[model samples]
Target: MAGAAELFVWWVLAVVLQVFLTGPLSWLEWTVAAGAAVPAAFGARAVRRASGAGSGGGARALHAVLVWPVALVADTGRLASLTLRALRGRQVRGRFQTLELGRGTGAAWACTLLSATPGAYAVGLGRGRFVLVHTLPGPPGVLADALTDGRRS
Candidate 1:
């Protein structure tokens, strides 16, 4: 029952967001549509149960949608800058370094942020003690600063 409720809520929220973006539907229409979606939420639980998955699909989907745009913009800027530098045949120094991160989900979040940004990628982890990252121009310190501050890290 909980799973169904979760699924319904996810679908309704998705519909609401779509209506908001499309802007063709009036608020009353959106509200009505959202209310109607409530029953479909149960389907989410069934899908998860059938797949034997534990994670909340709705939350994951929402996170992906939210993060992807930010990642794309950051990557685009990085690629443009790198391209400009490459045109001059500048010696692009690259750096590989490990960073100690707080345990658990924070580490994952940090890695995602780094991987999404341009000219940087989280390649691996070592000793479960640090995250390994590769960066162009060989300034691991700058990258570290960004990551630590929750900006580009």
Candidate 2:
């Protein structure tokens, strides 16, 4: 019953996302979206259950979505600046920094999300929920700063 509920929820989310991405759809498009949603929903449900990530992820997921584009754009600009600075004979340093991580799903999601941006690459999840990330010299992007604050702040 719980799995069924979760699957249904995932299906709805998949359909909604399809609509959001594609805009208004004709009957054929709706049929295609509904068909594609089943596999997408099952994949989401499987990943969630297999990973054993508990509920209460909605806010985190929403936060990640909001953070992603900003991080991408900010990091892109930062990278361009670094390139120009380096071309002008300024030193560009890349450093590895350790950030504290919360136990459970937050660490994985945070690392994955942070690494998706251009300026930071999470090296590993280390001792006591610490993650090592290598970042280009500059101000950390929004995602990295939020992640460095350790799941709250």
Candidate 3:
């Protein structure tokens, strides 16, 4: 029952966001939001009831939407430079490197950082323990060493 209510709430929220973000809202949009809201609110209430705590869904959703722009911009710059060097045929060396990563979300973040940066690609991940990366112009051993060193510090 609680699960059903949460699902309903999610549906309503989705409709509301869609309308709010992409309006001039028509009557149809408002109607949809209204129809979805009941289920959504009910589901949200159920989820809260079952969990014995208030849901952080709203905060988490907002955070997820707002947190990526800076990272994306930084990554784009790195990729552009790396791509230009590759196009110039500048002695590009590519090799695989395995990095030890911190557990859980930390490892995921590290992988994202590596893949987002230019000249490096995360090819594989292993259970939040290690990541296999392919880096151009060789291993960037010095850069890798610096990063690993920083992690230690």
The model with the greatest TM-score is 2
Which prediction has more favorable lDDT, 2 or 3? 2
Candidate 1 regions exceeding 4 Å error are 1-78, 103-105, 138-153
Candidate 1 structure quality by residue, lDDT tens digits, 1-153? 765556755586557656756788877888876776565445544554564434433443444446655655655676678778889997556677666643232344456556756756889765543678887663443334544433233
lDDT for each candidate structure:
0.57, 0.73, 0.54
Pick the lDDT winner. Answer: 2
lDDT of candidate 3 over 4-39, digit per residue (tens): 655665676667566756877779877877786676
Could you give the C-alpha RMSD of every candidate to the true structure, in order shown? Answer: 8.1, 4.8, 9.6
Please tell me which model should have the higher TM-score, number 2 or number 3. 2
Q: Where does model 2 exceed 4 Å of error? A: 1-57, 102-105, 150-153
Worst 10 residues of 1 by lDDT: 143-152
Each candidate's TM vs. the true structure?
A: 0.43, 0.61, 0.37
Pairs in steric clash, model 1 = 4-41, 4-42, 7-41, 8-41, 146-153, 147-153
